[model samples]
Target: MADNADRAGEIIENRLEGMLGAIALPPRTFAEPICVDCDGEIPAARRQAAPWCVTCAPCQSIRERGSRR
Candidate 1:
């Protein structure tokens, strides 16, 4: 019974990890330099660090909320 529980827990953990991975957006690429929405200039450092960023922090929050629906 203990072994069975451990196996079950492992399976659950793996599935949860997979689901979280699916929801996670890939990091930004360095190719793009501007925000698609507001046309705001993305800083060079930010582009390098978070290349997948489409909007600034404030706009991103708004976009995320809309996406949830």
Candidate 2:
């Protein structure tokens, strides 16, 4: 019974480590003030929210959806 409990705890710890590694954030770099796709204005609010955003909101959404597939 004690061995089984230790094994379960180890499995849970491994799973937690895997999840944390998967969700770890990548290093971000600065983006330009203009939208690269449509040449639209990138709002200051958006720039503040996502400093690494290169495209505008619409383009970013499309790109994200595409990447999901």
Candidate 3:
């Protein structure tokens, strides 16, 4: 029934919200305009996307790949 389905959806939504609330979220942060690793300009879009980034996209990708080994 439509009512039963709606009630089920509500229950699921409530449980998800509770779980999310219990989880810790990272603190908001800002980063320097220049990339620490490459000494390049950190793009405005990149800073907006990840305000905590210390490196530009290329440097960040390289670092992540190197760390995977």
Candidate with better TM-score, 2 vs 3: 3
Provide the TM-score for each candidate, comma-separated: 0.46, 0.52, 0.61
| TM-score, prediction 1 | 0.46
- Model 1: per-residue lDDT, tens digit, 1-69? 579889999999999999998896775558377777888877788777887776666677889899999
Ranked by TM-score, top first: 3, 2, 1
Segments in model 2 whose C-alpha atoms lie over 4 Å from true places: 1-30
lDDT of 3 by residue, 1-69 (tens): 579889999999999999999998655665679999989999988887788889999999999999999
For candidate 2, the TM-score is 0.52
Candidates sorted by lDDT, descending order? 3, 2, 1
Per-residue C-alpha lDDT of model 2 across residues 1-69, encoded as one tens digit per residue: 579889999999999999998995634645678999899988888887787788999988989999999
Query: lDDT scores for all predictions?
Result: 0.79, 0.85, 0.89
Q: Once superposed on the true structure, which residue ranges of model 1 sit more than 4 Å away at CA?
A: 1-29
Q: What is the C-alpha RMSD of each candidate to the true structure, in Å?
A: 4.9, 4.2, 3.3
Worst 10 residues of 3 by lDDT: 24-33
Better structure of 1 and 3 per TM-score: 3
